[model samples]
Target chain A: MPIAITDPDDPRIEPYRAVRERDLVGRQHRFIAEGEVVLRVLLKQPRFEIESLLLAENRLDGLSDALEDLPPDVPVYTANRQVMDAIVGFPIHRGILAVARRAPLLPLEEFLTALPEDALVVGLVGLANHDNVGGIFRNAAAFGAQGVLLDHESCDPLYRKAIRVSVGGALVVPFTRAPSAEAMVQALQAASFEIIALSPAGSEILSRVKPARRTALLLGAEGPGLPRELLARSRTVSIPMSGGFDSLNVATTSGIALHHLTSQKDEKPLPR
Target chain B: MPIAITDPDDPRIEPYRAVRERDLVGRQHRFIAEGEVVLRVLLKQPRFEIESLLLAENRLDGLSDALEDLPPDVPVYTANRQVMDAIVGFPIHRGILAVARRAPLLPLEEFLTALPEDALVVGLVGLANHDNVGGIFRNAAAFGAQGVLLDHESCDPLYRKAIRVSVGGALVVPFTRAPSAEAMVQALQAASFEIIALSPAGSEILSRVKPARRTALLLGAEGPGLPRELLARSRTVSIPMSGGFDSLNVATTSGIALHHLTSQKDEKPLPR
Candidate 1:
C-alpha cells in the first residue's frame, strides 16, 4: 500500500498536516507521533494502529528489524529529502514518521477494578503539555505507579509530543481519562480509596501519606497547581521543599508522589 | 545612547547574532530575551547585566517607568517593525529587545555560604532540557528550595527557553553552576549536610528520611538516574511505587523529595 507523493500538497497527508494547525494541534483527541525513533517504540505495542508512514528514499534505521510487525500491506511511502521536508513542513532528521491514531480510551471501571487490592491511581489534572504528560508517564512506568488518570482539562495523554517525551511509556502505562474532578474524587472515595492531593499547600508531607487499601494522587499543572477546589476536596499531602525556590513541574511532582505512595509497602513511612 | 542598524548582518550586533547559532539558539547563556516583558524581568536582577537595548518607537508598559534607569549612559537603540525585523532575523515582538550579558557563574562556595544556615540547595545532575531546568527552578522557588545548583552536565539555568519555561522564575531563583559532581558532593559533605539521593533501587522509603540539620536531595536526569558512585556516597531514600512502573522525573522527584524532607520538624521516631 505504499503510495508515492511527488507533490507535498497531497491530500493523503491531511491528518498529519492538520497536526501543525493551531486549533487542531493539541486538541486532536489523538496524537501524531511523527518521528522514526518514536514510531519504532510504538511498534512494540500490540494495539499500535499505524495509519501511515512517510519516509525518505534513504531508509532511516534498521527498518527491516524495527518494523517486522508491519504486515507487508502497510504503506511505507518513499520520497526524496526535499519531498519529505515539504511534506512534513520541517526537516525531520530521522526521516520516517508514522501517524498513530489514539488507542480507544480504556474503560474506567475496568481499570478501577483491575487494580490490586491496594492501588494508587496517579491522577493528572490540567497537565496540558504533551511532552510533560509523556515524561510523567515515562517516570510513572519506570517507578511502577499503578495507573495515570487525566482529569477533564488535561492534554491528550496519547498526543504525539507526549509519546516522544515519554519515550513510548505512553504505550505501556495504563491510563484513562477520568471524569470531572468531583466525579473522579467521589469514585475513588466510593471505592474506599483515599484521595491524596499532592499540593504545595498540603497539610501533611508526602512521606507521611498513610496508605489505606488504595490511594489516588491528584496532580495539577506546574504553575497553577491543583485548582483550589480540587485541593479542598481531597486530603492534602505536601512535599516539603527546603530550597527557597518556588514550584516544580507537575510531571515531576507526579513522579515523586507516585514513588512515595508506592514505596509504602517496603520501608519506614515518609513524612506526610 | 542608542544605536540603530538596518542591516541584519551588522557585526555590531554579534552578541545578538551569536544567539541564533545552533548550540546557542534559545539557550540561556547567549539567547537575547527580547521584549519589554522579558527585559523587565532581567532588570530586577543584579545578576543580569544589560549589554544593549533596542526600543521600538511606541510607549510600552514599564517603558514609561524605566526612563530614569536609561539615563544618558545605557545604549537604547530604536527601529520600526520593518527595520528591526531586518536587523533581527525574526519579527521582534514585544516592541523592545534587551541584550544582556549573562550573569557570571557563581562559585559553589559563594552559593553555599551566601545562604543562611540550613538552607536547601538543589543539586541537579544530567538534567539537560532548558525548560525542565527552568520548571525545576520554578517549583523549587514555589516550595522555597533555597538555591538551585547545576552540576557540569546540566543545562545552563539562564537560557531563554529555560527562562520562559520557568515563567520568569529563572530570573528570580538563585542558582550556581558547579561543574563537578564530585566537587559538589564534597562541598555538601563539608557543609555537614546529608545528601539524600532519591531513587527506587533501595528498600528505604522517603518517609524513612529523618529530617537532618542540612539536606541536599541530589537528582539525576530521567532514564539514567544518579550514578552508582553518587548513590553510594549518599543516603538512599526512595519514594515507593507500585511494582513494575517507572520512577518519577528528576525535577518532580526533587520537588516531592524536598517536600518530603522539609514538611515536619518533629524528631519523634516513627513506629516501624
Candidate 2:
C-alpha cells in the first residue's frame, strides 16, 4: 500500500531533501531515478534495489501501473505538489523520483573476462563530462554493445545529471572504471580484444576498417583526444569528415563508431 | 589597436553586461560566439559579421593571427579576468567571447531551391530544444548535407547557446524556418528530392534503403515523433536497434542516419 505523507519534515523522506546542495548518490550508495521513464527502467532492472519512491499526489494516478507491481515492502510516499517542492527544495517537473541503491561494481579484469568471444565494447579515456558518459551508455545500449570501460579520469556514470541525460541507460549498461587509460588498454589486449583508437590524425577511415571478432573502440576526451602512446600502440582510425569542420562530440563519435562496428552483414537489427 | 578597459561598468561594454539576466542574442539580431575554437570558425564564415570581440588580457597574445586579419574598424576590447566576469555575469572561463550579428535568414523555399541538384538535406519538425537543433546541424555539416529546413515550432538556430553547442555549425549551415511540417514536406517534394521520414515505427530499415540523387531526411522531436499524416506522405525509414532499448537521442539518430546515407561506395570523405 502507498503511504500518505503530509509533513515535509518527515524523517523517512530525508534522503530527498535539498538535492541541489549535494547529490545523495555521491554521498551515499543511493542514487535518484527521476521521472516515470527512468523509474520504469529501474523497476525492470534487478541489479538495483529500490530504496523508496517519492511522488507528487497528482502524479500518483498516472504511475499506478508502475506502483502496483513494486514489491510490497517498498514504500511509496505521496505528497502534494507544494509539499513535494518544499521537500526537494525545488520544483521537480518530472514529479516522480525513485531512490535506489547501486549494486556491487565489477572490477575491470573480471568484467573483461566475462564478455563473449565476439563482443563489441567501448573504452573511454579522460572523458570528464558526465553528460558524455551517460550519452555513451545510452548509445551503447541502443546498438547492443556488451559493456563500457572507463579510465580513472572519466566522470561517474551514476551522477544525477548523467542518469537523467541517458534516460536511465547509466543504470542499464554494464560499466567499470580502471586506474588509467594504459591499464584499461592492457586488460582488453590480454582478453584478446582488438583495440582501435579513434583519433583525428588516424590513418584508417572509419568506414573502411573491418573489426576483428572481438573489438574494443578506444575513445578519448573531446579536445585532447587519446594520449600519443595509446594511439601509437593500437590500430588507429578516424571518422572521415567534410574538410574544415571540427570533430564530432565525444558521445556522437561513439554512436557513429559503434553503429559501424556493430552492424552485421545483411544489416539485421540486433536482438535485445 | 586593441581597446583596454579596466572599469566593469563602462558604457562601451554595456552590450555584454549581465548576459544571464537576458540573452542579448534573442533580444536583437545579434548572437554571441564563445571560446577560441568558435571564434576561429566565426572568422571563417563570411555571413556573420563580427561586431566586436571581448577578449581577456591573457588571451589576446595567443590570438595574434586572428586579430591581425581583422578589419581596422572592428573594435577588439581587452579586460582583466575580474572585469570580464563582471561584464558577462559569469566566470567567462574560456577567456574569449565575441558578439556577432546574424545575417538575414533566407526564405524556406528560396533556400531549398538553392541546393545543388544532387544535394542531401535534413528537415526538422517541432524540435524546440536548442541543443538538439544545434546537434542536428553539427551532424548535418559533418556529412556535407546542403542545408536544414526547420518548421515554425523549432527553436532558432541563431540563439546563442545553439551556436555554441553546434561548435558554430549553426553559422556555417544554411537553414530556414517554414510555417509548418506539412508545408516543408511539400516544398521538398516539389524540388524533386526524395523525402525519408525517420520514425521508430518506420516500415523500411534505413541501411537497406538506397537514397535518390537528391534526398532529404525528415526528423521530428524525440517523444511524439513525426505526425502520421507526414509519415504517410513520405517514405518512412527506421534505424535498426536492439530490442527493448528506447530509440536513440534525436541528434544521435541524425548522426547515424546521415553517416549511413551519405557514405559513398569509395568511402571518401565528403568534400566541404
Candidate 3:
C-alpha cells in the first residue's frame, strides 16, 4: 500500500521540493530520477538504493507492477497534480519522480582489474555538457562498453537532467571518475588497454583500426578536443567526414566509434 | 553601415519581439537564427535571403567581416544588452540573432530528379523533436549526405532550436517535405533509390548491407519507429546492439548509420 500526502509542504516529500533549483546546488550524494521509465530502471539496478518515490495520484495504478517488486521498506508517496506541481516547483507531465542514493565511487585500480580480457570501454575528458555525458552513456550501454571512465572535469552522469537524457542509461552503466585525463591514460596503459583517442586530426581512420584485446576509446569536448599530448601518445583515429565539415557532436561521435570498435572482431592476437 | 535602435518596441524590430512566444506560433515564412556560428552560416547560404540582423552593440565590431559581405539593402540593427533581452522576452546569452526568410519548399519530384547519380540523403518520418531533427541534419551533413527529405508529419527544420542544435547544418543542408511517407517511398523508388529503413526489428544488420549507387536512409521517431508497412517495403536494417538494450537516440542512430553507409564503397552498379 502507498502513502497519500495532501500538502505540498509535507516533510515526507521534502526532498522533491524545488527540484530545478536544487539541481544547480548539489544533491548531497542523492539524485532525483524523473519519468516512469527512469524509475523502473532505478528499481532494477542493484548498484543504487532508492530513497523514496513521489508520484501523481493518477500514476499509482499504472506503476503497480514496478511497485510490486519494490522492497517493502521503500516509501511510495502519492499527491494530486496540484500539490505535486507545487512541491517540484514545475509542471512535470510525466508525473513520476524518485530519489536515489548514489553508489560509492570505486577506486580506479579496482575497476580496471575487474575488467574482462575482451573489454571495451569509454573514457570521457572535459565534457561539461550533461546531455553529451548522458548520450555517451546511452551509447556505451547500447554498444556493450564494460564501463565509463570520466576525468574529474566531466560533469556528473547522475545529475537529474543527465539521467533523464540518458533514458535511464546512467543508472544501468557502471562509471567512475579519475583525477585527470593524463592520469586516466596512464592507468589504462598500465592495465594493458589500447587507448584510441578520437580527434579530427587523428593519424588513422576509424574503420581501418583493428581492436586490441582490451580497447578504450577516449573522447574530448567539442571545440578543444583531447589534449595534443594525449593524441600524440595514443593511437589517434579519425572518422572520415565530409569535406569542409569536421564537426560531429561528441556524443554522436562516440556512438559511431563504439559501434565500429565493438562490432569488429579482434583480428590481432593479444600483446603479451 | 549599421543602424542603431535604442528602444525594444521600435517598429523596425517588430519581427524580433518576444521570440520565445513567437516560436510556438508560426513565424510566417521567417525563421530566427541565433548565435555567431549560425549567423555566419545564414549569411553564407545564398538559398535563403536575410531580412535583418539584431545584435548587442558589443557584437558589431566582431561581425564586421561578415557584415561587409551583406547585401546593401539588408538592415543590421544594434541594441544594448538590456534592449535586446527585453525584445526577445528572455535572456539570450549568445547576444546575436537574425531573422531570415525560409527557402521555398521544392516539390518532392523535383528534389528527387535533382540528385546526382551517386547521391546520399536522409529521409525523416514522424520526427517531431527539434533537437533530434537538428542532430540528424548535423549527422547528414557530416557524412556528406546531399540532402534531407521530410514527411509531412515532421516538424519544421528551420525552427530556431533545431537550427541551433544542428550546429548550423540545418542552414547548410538542402531539404524538401513530401505530402506523406508513402508518397516519399513511391517517389524515391521511382528514382531508383535503395531506401533503408532504420528500425530495431530490421531484418538486415547495418554493417553487412551494401549500399547502392543512390541510397536513402529513413529514420522515424524514438518510441514508435517507422510504420510497419514502410519497413516491409524498404530494405530494413538494424544496428546490432547489446542484449536487453535496444534504444538509441534517433540522432545518434543517424550518425552511426550515416557514417557506415557513407564510408563504405558502393559495390552495386546502378540499375537502368
Count of steric clashes across candidates, in order: 53, 0, 0
- Pairs that collide in candidate 2 are none
DockQ of 1: 0.44
TM-score evaluated only on chain B, model 1: 0.79
Give the alpha-carbon lDDT of every model: 0.69, 0.85, 0.90
Pitting candidate 1 against candidate 3, the one with the higher TM-score is 3
Q: Give the CAPRI class of candidate 3.
A: high
Best by DockQ: 3
Model 2 per-residue lDDT tens digits across residues A82-200: 88999999998888888888887798999989988778889999998988998998898888888889999998887788888888788878888889999999999999989999999
Query: Of the candidates shown, which would achieve the greatest TM-score relative to the real structure?
Result: 3
| Ranking of candidates on DockQ, top first | 3, 2, 1
Q: Please tell me which model should have the higher lDDT, number 1 or number 3.
A: 3
- Candidate 2 chain A minimal-lDDT segment of 10 residues: A263-272
User: Against the hidden true structure, what lDDT does model 2 obtain?
Assistant: 0.85
Give the per-residue lDDT digits (tens) of candidate 3, residues A13-115: 9999999999999787899999988888888898889999999999999999989878899999999999999999999999999999999988887898898
**Model 2 regions lying over 4 Å from their true place:** A265-272, B6-9, B265-272
B-chain TM-score for every candidate: 0.79, 0.94, 0.96
DockQ, candidate 3, vs. native dimer: 0.83
DockQ of each: 0.44, 0.69, 0.83
| Residues B248-267, model 3: lDDT tens digits | 99999999999888767533
As for candidate 3, its clashing pairs are none
